[model samples]
Target: MFSGLPQDYSSITVTNDGWWPDTDVADFQSQRSIPASIKTETVASALLMAIGEANAELAAYQSAQRAKGFSSAKDVTGPSAGGVNQLCAQYLKIIFARAKAELMGEITSAEREKANPGQQSEDTRDRLLAEASFAIRNIMGHPRVTVDLI
Candidate 1:
């Protein structure tokens, strides 16, 4: 319910649709195939958890910006101004979708989840997770490893 927080979704989505809509997940659906046991309500709960986690991760940057006396994010308008905003949207969509999939017992490769036994291969889940973290770093920027005493 926070103001200036992307309205929990953008103009492209119906105002009430959870994080990333089912329609928006065609790639995941085709690749993984949704498990029959995962109910709509369960997905909703997972989405809430995912949104909370994403918000927590972004809080530090939001706090820093507020301390600078920027009235709010809405006042800014430009491609560069939208960097954090764009990243924030992408972060929520991806993190939530992944969480929901995991909750549905679909943690394996999308191909594996598709029941493709022949394609079952070495576990690359860790690598994918690392890549996701790298993307997040692009959004958040690398931490300062040293401080100058100037």
Candidate 2:
């Protein structure tokens, strides 16, 4: 439903209550305490990486869709239950995980103490992270190709 790019990657929702039901943002949120300010650079890197991985895993399908003149997942409308949906869902998870990593950060003893009078190190070891899972790939099923030998 996009004339150009998909919903600016940041807008991709992971909640089942959102457009895609296959995944729930809560599933990931339950793992990590997402931060308020994630860096743009970090978000872009994570989004690009997630896109590459998904395109690689679903290359044939992606190629076929491109061949049909649909540039990317954004061009897709909805079945609400299909490849594009799954890809976007997975992509969102990855972006969230990578971006959130920066939020759940740790500072050295000198670092934290510098800001506070008696503070020590900011140990982020206890911080939880949402690992990007590929459940959508399995849910979407295998990519198929027509084998014709001349």
Q: Write the per-residue lDDT of candidate 2 for residues 10-65, one digit (tens) a residue.
A: 33332221222233333333334332134334444443444455445556655675
**Candidate 2, residue 130: how far the Cα is off, in Å:** 9.7
**C-alpha root-mean-square deviation, each candidate:** 10.7, 13.1
Runs of candidate 1 exceeding 4 Å displacement: 1-37, 69-85, 104-114, 117-124, 143-150
TM-score of each: 0.48, 0.37
| Per-residue lDDT of model 1, residues 1-150, tens digit only | 124532121112112223222222323333334433344444445545654555566667556656776444432332433345554444544554445434533323433445754334333444434544555565567642436798
* Candidate 2 Cα outliers beyond 4 Å, as residue runs: 1-33, 81-87, 94-133, 139-150
Q: Which ten residues in a row have the lowest lDDT in candidate 1?
A: 7-16
TM-score of 1: 0.48
Candidate 1 collision pairs: none
Whole-model alpha-carbon lDDT for candidate 2 = 0.41
Evaluated at residue 10, the lDDT of candidate 2 is 35
